[model samples]
Target: MSELNVELSETERSFGLRQIPAGHARMLVIGRCLPQPIGEVWNALTDPARIGAYFAEPQGDFRRGGDYELPGFSRGTILRCDPPRLLTVSWMPAHGNGGELEIHLADENGATRVELLYASVRKRFAVMDPEVNEWAAGPGWEFFLDNLSAHLDGREVRPTDRDWQSMEGTDRELYEARNTEWVRVREEFEREHSPLPSPE
Candidate 1:
């Protein structure tokens, strides 16, 4: 399979603060269009076999209220599952910074549009440390979308961990350039939407 270019120009990213039961959390919204039908895109996201092909090997029950784990990535419960439309899950990583993740799918023209929303509580003193900001989540999701695109295009999809380690020459440079663009986008988001006060 041939490699696909990392294209952020086709993606729409937004950031905001949302009030959840726990408190105020940072929310990252990423929207992108896939060159496939909505049903195909939805299946790739929900089917264990298909997901494993592009994303991670998901284990455990897949229904609402069921628990699931993405091996080394994250483990969470399925909060909601609406076929070919919306999927919401609780996201709990090993770092213990838990959050909620929502995947919304829609038909755009003849293709499918995917919107991924992740909201995690802001860590205390997060402002003191620039590295802890929510913007850090941007690149990971972008990488996933890129992988998804490749899978839909019938190309081999490299696992995130292996992809980074194996990337070289132009591929590695492209990935780094994408990361830099994400940083700029995050800065612009912060300037336009001031963060909400940290919940007491």
Candidate 2:
């Protein structure tokens, strides 16, 4: 899959959705870069008012040790906060499955590179819906990231970009194909890395 476009090509942009195998569960990491300044991009992510303009309005103190509630989505606790640089949060979706999210930001030339790692995805998600690893979480964040780009550019958020379930055309096809590949790779990684039963 190519880096998503919103009219102009993001020359310095990078995009990825991958699972890193671990002892217990795979880590779901979705990363991308926006063709925007680091400060602006940081504000777009951290400011509640700015976030509400793009993503859901999270209710929380938004400080270290504070917890945020994004109704109908994920409830997150602020584990660490560093201005315009890094933010780590513990994410627990309404379904009760939990994970750790590490948000890292940097200035690359003039664009902002954002990397998010959502760690220790529960086994049940893959077991229940192997078709979409990260399940709704992957595509959902992708949508929000697109909205963040829109918010920075001072344009209306693309309607189709609002929800992952409403994907269409080439994006839908590519997304499904990518998911299939992820499932295959993750299964292979698990099979190879899984420790064998001892003294059975």
User: How many pairs of residues collide in each model?
Assistant: 0, 0
For model 1 the TM-score comes to 0.82
Roughly what TM-score does model 2 have, to 2 decimal places? Answer: 0.72
Can you write out model 2's per-residue Cα lDDT over 166-196, one digit (the tens) per residue?
5678756545555554466456656776742
After superposing candidate 1, which stretches have Cα over 4 Å from the reference?
1-6, 122-136, 162-167
- Clash count, predicted structure 1: 0
Best by TM-score: 1
lDDT of each: 0.74, 0.63
Worst 10 residues of 1 by lDDT: 125-134
Quote the lDDT for 128 in model 2. Answer: 22
